[model samples]
Target: MAWMSWTLPTAMFFITIAVILISMTAWQIISPCIERRGFLPLATTRGDRLFIGLLSSAFIHLAFVALTDVNIAVATALCAIWMIVLMRWG
Candidate 1:
């Protein structure tokens, strides 16, 4: 089946996204977040950071694919680090 044809990396990517969404939902239900000014120029909440991080990560991955020979594993690792930083202190 088409849905069953995912490679390891494809499966991992979706699984990671699902886990992040589930955890974020639980965190919001447990203790809500307050917007704050971080290293970023503007104040943002968790959701904003997630959106920004993911958007930038997509561009980074596209750039890597279009301009370099770097492996996707490297891009994924960098994206993960970027997401963590933005979520914690963007």
Candidate 2:
């Protein structure tokens, strides 16, 4: 197979996303989603929160990269924390 060019961080990012998607699918099969209200203005299901989390993560990364000299690691860490919060309570 011909390999595509990708850096370690890029490869890890896609791998992480794939793992999350697989786990989410398994969770859905094991227990169907039920909507709930939390910090968000409206009730949302797991899938909804996942989408919102991803958007917020992208926004966070963009803001961090554009506005500050902080390391990408720090930005990624912030995105991760945001994802966990959204998943748990958004």
Candidate 3:
């Protein structure tokens, strides 16, 4: 896709997503998950929670970038923390 600039950061982002997906799939195969209720309103499986976490993290990053002048690292750190919390007790 020459139309799009495949910069290092962009490439790394996509690679990271691919790696996460692969790892999750392997995890599922090794140990199937049961749907469980957490702080979130509905019972959800690991994959469901992961999807929600990633989607929410996207919004979190967008909000950070749009609403503040702080470094993007702050958003990344927040997203990491939020992901851990969500995966553990969302």
Best by TM-score: 3
lDDT of 1: 0.91
Tens digit of lDDT per residue, candidate 1, span 1-90?
A: 355778898899899889988998898889999999999999998988998999999999999999999998899899989989999889
Worst 10 residues of 2 by lDDT: 72-81
Q: Between the candidate structures 1 and 2, which one is better when assessed by lDDT? A: 2
User: Which residue runs of candidate 1 sit more than 4 Å off their true CA positions?
Assistant: 1-4
lDDT of each candidate versus the true structure: 0.91, 0.94, 0.95
Residue 64 error for model 2, in Å? 0.5
Error of model 1, residue 1, in angstroms: 13
Best by lDDT: 3
Structural similarity to truth (TM-score) of each candidate: 0.84, 0.88, 0.95
Cα shift from native, residue 22, model 2 (Å) = 0.8
- Cα RMSD of all models vs. native, in order, equals 2.2, 2.7, 1.4
Candidate 2: the clashing residue pairs are none
Task: List the candidates ranked by lDDT, beginning with the highest.
Answer: 3, 2, 1
Off by over 4 Å in 2: 1-4
Clashing residue pairs in candidate 1, if any?
none
Task: For residue 56, give model 3's deviation from the true position in Å.
Answer: 0.6
Residue 1 in model 1: lDDT: 38
